[model samples]
Target: MSGTILEMKGICKSFPGVKALQDVDFDLRAGEVHALVGENGAGKSTLMKILSGVYRPDAGEIRLHSKVVSITSPLVAQAHGISIIHQERRLFPALSAAENVFAGRLPRTSAGLVDWERLNRQAKEYLDLLGFQPDVRTPVGELSVANQQLVEIAKALSMNPKIIIMDEPTAPLTDSETEQLFAIIRQLKARHVAVVYISHRLDELRQICDRVTILRDGRRVGHHLVAEVSNSEIVRAMVGREIVERFPKVVAPRGPLVLRVKDLSQKKRLKNISFEIHRGEVVGLAGLVGAGRTELARCLFGVDPFDQGEIEVAGEPRRIRSIQDALKAGIALAVEDRKRQGLVLSMSVRHNVTLASLEKISRLGWLRLGAEQEIVQKQVRDLAVKTPHIDQLVGNLSGGNQQKVVLAKWLAKQFDVLILDEPTIGIDVGSRVELYELINDLAKSGVGILLISSDLPEVLGMSDRILVMREGSLVADLERGEATQELIMQYATGSVDARVERCGR
Candidate 1:
């Protein structure tokens, strides 16, 4: 916390009928890792975009090092030593890691031709700094989500930027990878490079950030030093309320067993997996990254074929060979990556709403546009999806809005069982509450839900029973009354004491 490197004062922005930002104030200091936090559509993204030259402030002043500057484009921002790594990665899949890093500005030889050696060497150096070693020649298309995020960081660092804006950089990273990233941040701090670290993990901010700025509804709500703010205090400031008891479990009716799996295995990803989800109950699959939580979800949802397993839905064993079969069996899955597998980006809200159940809106091969609009409108209101209209493109919506659309699509299908993978990943405080209420309502209506999420608090809050996973294996099965943060963590990381005497046993 020293001299200020960048500042934005009285920033204001609007889109159509919505005021995305209003009179926001923010500043970043040299040699400091400043954190910016807010829920989706809270104006955090909009304000950062203005600072990085993606959007011009409707009314404001930007000063860099005591002198004002107008950033008209991304290139201009880069020239002024500012860069942003988006939450949704924008790397080209067809290119190699080295190529993606040096996409626009590749090294050239004397004749102005490509210099592969220099490009690979430079990319390898950055990758090494991030504790990653992969074939630079391999295309980015083959890399996992975590590895792809590292490439994004490498691209930002390649610019030798004076200020780097990281948006949810740790969303895809595992625990070890996240620690490595923190180490890299410390190295950047020593080099006097200002970093704007944006993430939903409040605890991580307390550990790494020098200062934090909270944005709500596109306005600066509060700013405080990390040492002066407690986690509960920060949550109150962000959501304007106390979030007591993060995981609030209730006694469910526990109707008939809706889903049963035995010997479920998908080659190497899943092995001998077995579980049962009952109607009017919420079963949570808790685990760290790459612990087969998502792999099991995919297997259950028909995204991946099971090498060997028997699935019994509603007490009848059946084969879920494809997504269509899963739908026919009344299984609805809000995928982990909603943008990638859950919703069609290029489609309209109305189209996506009815996508999973075209039969409901189709009459004898003739589309009923009026009937479709009515259903779409009902879901939009039911789920509180923020869109200009049903005709609005899903791609143009915010992350939370897009997620709501996916949920709406599934709700329209009237599934008996719903599998939500990270349903509230990037949503804001208010929307998270809304989702919780919806899930509770669904459970009351006898819908069996298998909730998979990385947020420990959320998993604990809404689950009737919790299952901990580690390295593709189920480590513990704890009831709601028996679960605790420490106990769940121990099982999740494989620290469970097998020698301990069981109280009931």
Candidate 2:
């Protein structure tokens, strides 16, 4: 659309036991949305980190406006009119939304004190522009994940940047919220701003991006106009092969009931939620952002208490008061926020994997190192997790790999039911297929799975039956053959009346 506004030449970066990027070259044109896509650990984030001054390139040259410049720190990057909205929320949880939006650049009065009125007013302007309706004075910690993501976007826009990098910006947002974000991106493009959009959702590229650059194993592999390449071609380039089936759903033989919830009520969060997952079955829980899918999962997993409910595991009633109670009852939950609720980031991969199954790998309260290694190694290898060693910190691995470790933790244990919440949010297309296959395998092994996802296609493809939720209640339960994207939306958005079949129940 315009002349090149930024160029990165021969960029190379390395970490211990990893060559994160290898002589990668990327250029961004003004007034265009350029997409950077790759499998996790393929160096998509690494290259962007280098550009945003989060990491320095071992060998590279960065030019902005045709002039070489060194971005030594985040402040330096900001000074150069470059801003980034990270995949992870990087805000002070204790601070108000307005305060976080203008954290470093708050308005000050003549007396050198913070001008609270102007600071909030300016912050509200940006949030309002993005169609974010939350109060500006609310603490970020109190907001929903989608609202927190909007705050990150608002913070970046407040900088009045010439270039902005958004990493998986819509992962936590609803379909409506994602559309709003796209509209904002369009407006920014009209103002001659360049955007570096990174996401695992391939379908989004054709919708909002102008050009795409693909990376594989830390090297630039392919670059093309979004209009010229098909999604299948892009998938092939990113993974180095063709993915025959994106959702390889296996029709495992259903067995006796493994999990059942009766009259589950969590005050205003969940209302009379009732569902059943038989052994060797994948029951998809589909809903919009605030349709209470996650809340139901949390209630089942004991992360939050349910005011009134009856949980049955293998036809035996049980009271799950805590995580330990849930696990003891042969239930496991892989939460949506892997970094926070799922895995302990500071721990080694091996430790995190074995953390959930210590009893199986220990003797007399002493860890059996050999048994631990054996289990962790198998899980890591089976998941195809890219890691130098088991001792590598889970935080050092890519987001997708980190998620694999979370699943590995549960896999190492004996569980009759597995609850996976947004399991493929940030995973690449290739990795997502692998996860689907893994889900099939798990179901084949007689573990009932409750898959909670906002991804409609995934729900429709992998599920034996789809349960639609709306306003904290179960609205519709459609068989795999009867479920469609449009029908699911109608049920989720209350466009259709509740019509649930007693299939699983």
Candidate 3:
């Protein structure tokens, strides 16, 4: 909102067989949270990397405070008061929160000795300012994903940066955690720090960002003030196409119950959780971070054992003590962390798509390459997964295509219940519409979907029914018509224990 502090003028970057960026110009004003948005392969990351000095631009000049500057490395960028906090948090899990924040740059006492007392005190002050009061001595590994991210922020702020680049910082956060992050960003804004926030969540940009820049296939497309552009317009700018509707939930008449859980309990994570998912129904699981949404999904998928529960598959009680047991009982989990759990990055699309259904694609002890290719090819075409070939490495595909490949695994099987955790977390607009269509088709085909997402609009848009969880308990259940964003948040934050009154209302 004030004078420009950082500017990348006509930047161009390229690699073998790929031009990551092309003549892109970006400017950041002090005290402004400017959004950088695009699809996965649109070079948003590439541009930011150049800004952070990770990669040198092929052709361009960077200006800081209207003066030309050379940033040869990340250290140089930091020296110039530039800090980047990546989506995958860079922290030492074994180290304490304070130690991680001051890992390389810890204060030294007069005699060239470590200053432990000062380190913890300084870290505590930053954490308190951000409204994040985790124990400074606690190992980062012991903290939840949300808290670890907060620690990451504290580390960035310790640099006393003038420019901060936050890449998908809130992808792993829940609603309340996101609010906490926003508060910290506001504090930075008050200090006149410029933030370059890179995310695929457009609504988030509207709320906190002052302006937005869109990139597509290595080229700058459009830049606009947040107040002037609508969400769909932003999508159009980023994707070069209109996203007519974000959610494509076609009415699928409900069928008989396919899964039923009675008194599901998992220590401090889930307490007496019970739910029913019928065939052709999409039940959305909504909650804030640490409200036990992912934990419940893990329990249901047999990734973690439940203390006490009755899991009924098609009216027959079954013991699901392992992942294989869960699969055998016609339950499959498309985990939240797609990069780590859902697919093997090193594997080809064909290999990953056929991973869970290997038995069906192979004979006794012999690999069936033909059957594998055919199945993967069909799935790719059906899901509209944009890939060079079925043999293409999944690691190279976009976020949306990667998610489709994860779904292809389940689509290969005859699973009665599918648990999709944060299915559209990092995907763009057009691909999200495609995914929503796929979800609707799956439900129409009598496949039950238990969608667990931190994206409230996505849940409200696609769910046939919404279930709210808070502090490891199911506090509210409501039909699609009765479930509003305000109502769900109230239940999620424990403002109301209206489970009896709100359930089925």
Candidate 4:
């Protein structure tokens, strides 16, 4: 048998104004974890979609196990022992976990009814294989995002496919969940399954991937064995530039406290979280996944109501009951999930950029098109947002550009304080640097910044002070000079005592 399980040669795909993929070539081997990596819109996803039959390649030849094959549809791909786990999961929320797992090919009884017992049994077996134990009969909507992702993986594994393609599988998972996933990948390797792993986290890829293929601007720029490639080299190949420093920290003089959260507590998530951010200062919220960082931001943004708290803005007590009220109170939030919470994909880039401050671009209760365009144009230039034009749909832009649009939307609105939750999630290394620069610039402009992220290095590098959260409580406050990876991880993983022993003091 041939060592290769899959291969695509000279693949080319294009959208209306963008060449998504241009003459890209890729290959996968049996029992190997091959990583596909690139900047957002660097044609990584496009090439993977073509391989999985989600998108028909404009021109290419796919060879399966040393033989040329045509993959016209997803069913055809599945028939050939191929499966793809999408970043955005497509689970049936109303159905039970077992039912969703055995959605299309459920075992049936002699009378043509689904065998519920067998269904749960099979689903439980699959979950067990991944070191997970959830009630198979329970509805999928009730499960957390990380659990839902595991269920998706279990569903894919149940097919007993020879090739499995996973995209950003660990984006929403915790550290433990990520470890579990790595274990599963090892098991798949033992079974000789060819795994294609796609992720933006270069460090994790080094830990799990055996080989890597990097694409840039729809072309396969480089491919190398993981042992021979460094993170900086991969980053340079993906972005076509050498980044001198990962974090660009430019400290501005701190001013008086612009906002203060006193005893902020939310149901089941945040417990008496108190912090303060001074004007022209970046305050970091550091924690593990599900550590109430996002919950605290949401409460402050009025997306979720807090049970008890006092919010003082510019030395005045404010009542923020909704997002509208928060905006009017000179507070802006750039949410974590850009697709779900930040941008309306169907709208044009111009529309999304000016969405928050429509009143500023309106005359006599009507939108001024020229004013809106000028604002968007300036933001696009300032942020270096790469798009065809302002009239282009936001949905068509890549993840990095979409995030820039979200930033632009908030920038258009005049605000005293800005809260950013995981602002660099899934973005490329270069784009992350740009975002850091933008944050520094904003902080220098006297905007109090609250940066919430699980990336410890990012928090330590960018913040003036870091506040650590455990479970639902604020456990430690560390100045930038005192914060280290060891100290942060000790608190984040709950290995250190949370009795407020003055760790970061």
Candidate 5:
């Protein structure tokens, strides 16, 4: 490692009934990317929160250049040249990109008025430096999630901090966009700025990190150079066991068709989309960011009403124009944005897990608390959700645990068709493998699954069939053995051979 720039000793923090961190220690160098990785609720975020003043550690000593300092708030941390990019973006949707980037520290003219021209110009410079050139004057809400990630990075760069902490920075980024982020990280490193990179993706650590720190059950278990340890070693340290297969895709004869879509269309977003999901099979959706994959999912789940389409549920034509209709039709959707659309952060794990099937836990305007507890307890145990208690707030749980809660909510139902949008988006490798096995188990149990993800290998490994969406339309349909990474990418990018089929039937 290079010269030590910061260190934390005996860091400890606790919430009401949960001890998030306990005597944890960490250090950073002048020009190195240190990766912090662990399973959900393993105290990775808790430790970083303490360092960034989101939470004050119960016991810890922070020394910068060998001088002990106290950081009691986010402003104090910022004053000490520390800035953090949270995993969830905190931007004003109604504001423009430039306005979001230079929100708090806007330039002022000599007359004591805000200078819009200089603000947009400087924000554009940062955006271009990061290889993101969205219209600065446009509302950020209109931009894609990947572009919003770049804007978050631009906001961090405007801070001119000595240390930058990125939490799951590439969770929503595509392959090319991720590479652009790596380039920016390297540039920051060359300027002698320390970066604390946190993510669940192990391959990213191998490519961009210098040293890796492993956390499990709120304790530091291993710290080693990326070159000294194999990825398997880190996985073992994270989950306390070996994960042989990251994607446990099963191969079995599929049953009868459970869902069939014909000529599904929405205004400008989806066009002539058609597909089928059979019982005991997993169908993967592959496409670029704006290729209408999510739009199709929404249409199926009744989140977005399709302009024209024919949907067949278990050999019977059904009209699913709303959530109630979809639920009655034996269809469900575990949406892509877990934080925004799926789970309620202000609620408890117990409440969230039983949200979808509240009718089952209620009796004619009366509530059955005992039954709800039983149902939620089983789900927590099945999903291995790490929490002090079932009553713990969902917001306090880690990203992986929150996602599990979302799944638990839908799994509580008896739906025959399930649509999982980005099922394993930001989860750890161990959790990803567990989810793959879960999906396979569901399929084996005669449940049809529609899996959507941006990861190419994930789609190729777990899916029994792949459906390629391009420019709001279904472009290709390939069976598991017939599909290849290159072939899917070609179809997804809208440059494919004539051999690829354009229709589902």
Candidate 6:
């Protein structure tokens, strides 16, 4: 409801073998939250990068307050009153939270020396506004993922920019932290700061965004007022088709148990965890942040050691003290943080996909090139991964595509059970549907799945059974027929009675 503050016209950018953006147009009005959305590799991030001076557009013109200007670098963009919180964490891991927040703009004393005390106080003030209470002196790497995200928000706000870009800002936050962020956005609106919000979570658009622009295949396809369009319509525009079923959960014949965990306990991270996944069944793991969902996944995958537990794969108790042991036992885990744990970024798609199945493709420790190529080609085609070629670096692909590569690595091998931790996190609606269909297909193929996610609807729609965790303990196990968003939240937050029938105990 205010005058136009920013406009980009005829934006065109290209990468080797990829046309990232093509003549795209976008505009922003002061005091409004405008959303940028699309499927993976749809040019959303590329356009934002251009605007934030991370990449120079091959051809485009930017007008700010009716005057044309060139943004040559991040420092220039900041000087022009622009700041961005990237989807990926960009803070210095070894630096203290306060130091990272005021990296280039640290306050100085009267003598022109570094004012450490004032810097910490100011950083704490910004973090306090977002309801985060980590010690300012602590290194950012020591903080949890959710807390690190809060630090990113605080760092962006320290610049006092006129236009702020948020890319998937809530992917790592809890419900309360997300609400606190919404409160801060409202305050930014009251102060007339324009916000460009980029997220794969379309539902948030209706709640926080004023308008939205949808792109697909490097082109601007649709733009609309948030209130005037349905989420389905937006999905159609982004994917160019009707997603009839977001979760195509097919009920396969439940066979014998494939994975069983009994009396699993860790040092204050997991407490007597017990669960079972039958062949061809999908089990949903639901909980808030810090509920030990990820910790359980890590323990089962042998990324971390457990104090006491028994893991049974196909009725055979096995000791999984390392990742190699877990894989050898037919247990595969698609970790929560794919960028760090699941896939090697510097590796090529061909290499990452076949990294786990080298033994199958090799004989006498000599990898057969023909077998390797055949496996990677099949997976690339089956998953519909949009890459120039299998040789492309995993880091060059979009978030969703990278996630598919992670799954492809595990799928390349024969496994009895698959643990997908946050499989759909930071992924677009269209990509999510593809993943859901893939899950259904995998279940139909008799691979038991353990799905861990914060999206309650995804759990309700895809799982035959839901497991809820609270404070490092399994509290409730509800069948799909009896589970609802409200009930799951109650169990996750411990608002309801914590006593419940423990499955597989």
Winning model by TM-score: 2
RMSD of each: 3.3, 2.1, 3.3, 2.9, 2.6, 2.3
**Which prediction has more favorable lDDT, 1 or 5?**
5
- The estimated TM-scores of all candidates read 0.91, 0.96, 0.89, 0.92, 0.93, 0.95
**lDDT tens readout by residue for model 3, 1-505:** 6898888899998765567789999999999999999886688877888888888889999999989998899999999999998665779989999998888998889998889899999999877766676789999988877688888888888899999999888877766668878988998999999999998887789889999999988899999999998887888888788877777788799999889988899887888877888999999999887789989888888899999989988788999898877877878888777655667778888888876444543343234566767877888887777676888787766555677788777776667898998887777777777778878988998988999987888999999999998988888888899989999989888887658444322
User: Which lDDT tens digits does candidate 1 get at residues 249-307?
Assistant: 55568899888877788878776777778899898888888789988888777878889
The regions of model 5 sitting more than 4 angstroms off are: 356-370, 498-503
Residue-by-residue lDDT tens digits, candidate 4, 1-505: 1288788999999999889888988998889999999887787767777877888999989999889998888888899999888776779988888888888989998999999889999899888776666788888888777678888988888888899999888877778888988998998888999999999999899999999999887788999999998888999998899999899999989998899888888887888777788999998988888788888888888889999999988888999898876876678899776655677888899888876434453333334566777888988877777787888998788766788898888776678999998888777788888889988998999999999988888999999888888998888888889889899878877898764544222
Task: Pick out the ten consecutive residues of candidate 1 with the lowest summed lDDT.
Answer: 496-505
Q: How many residue pairs clash (N, CA or C atoms closer than 3 angstroms) in each of the candidate models, in the order given? A: 4, 0, 0, 0, 0, 0
Stretches > 4 Å off in candidate 1: 241-245, 356-384, 497-505
Candidate models: Cα lDDT each: 0.81, 0.89, 0.83, 0.84, 0.85, 0.88
The deviation in Å at residue 425 for candidate 3 is 1.6
Candidate 2: worst-modelled 10 consecutive residues by lDDT: 357-366
Tens digits of per-residue lDDT for model 6, 1-505: 5999999999999999999999999999999999999998898878988889999999989999989989889998999899999877799989999999999889999999989999999999999999988799999988888889999999999999999999889888878899999999999999999999988888778889999999999999999999999998999999999989888778888988999999899999899988899999999999988899999988898889999999999999999998778877877888777655567788899988886434453343334656888888888887778899999998898777888898788777777889999888877777777778878888888899999998889999999999999999999998989999999999998999875566674
Candidate 2 lDDT tens digits, 79-113: 99999999877999999999999998899999999
The Cα RMSD of model 1 versus the native structure comes to 3.3
In terms of lDDT, model 2 sits at 0.89
Error of 3 at 57 (Å): 1.9
**Ranking 3 against 4 by TM-score, winner:** 4
* Ten contiguous residues minimizing lDDT sum, candidate 5: 358-367
How good is model 4 by TM-score?
0.92
lDDT for position 396 in model 6: 90
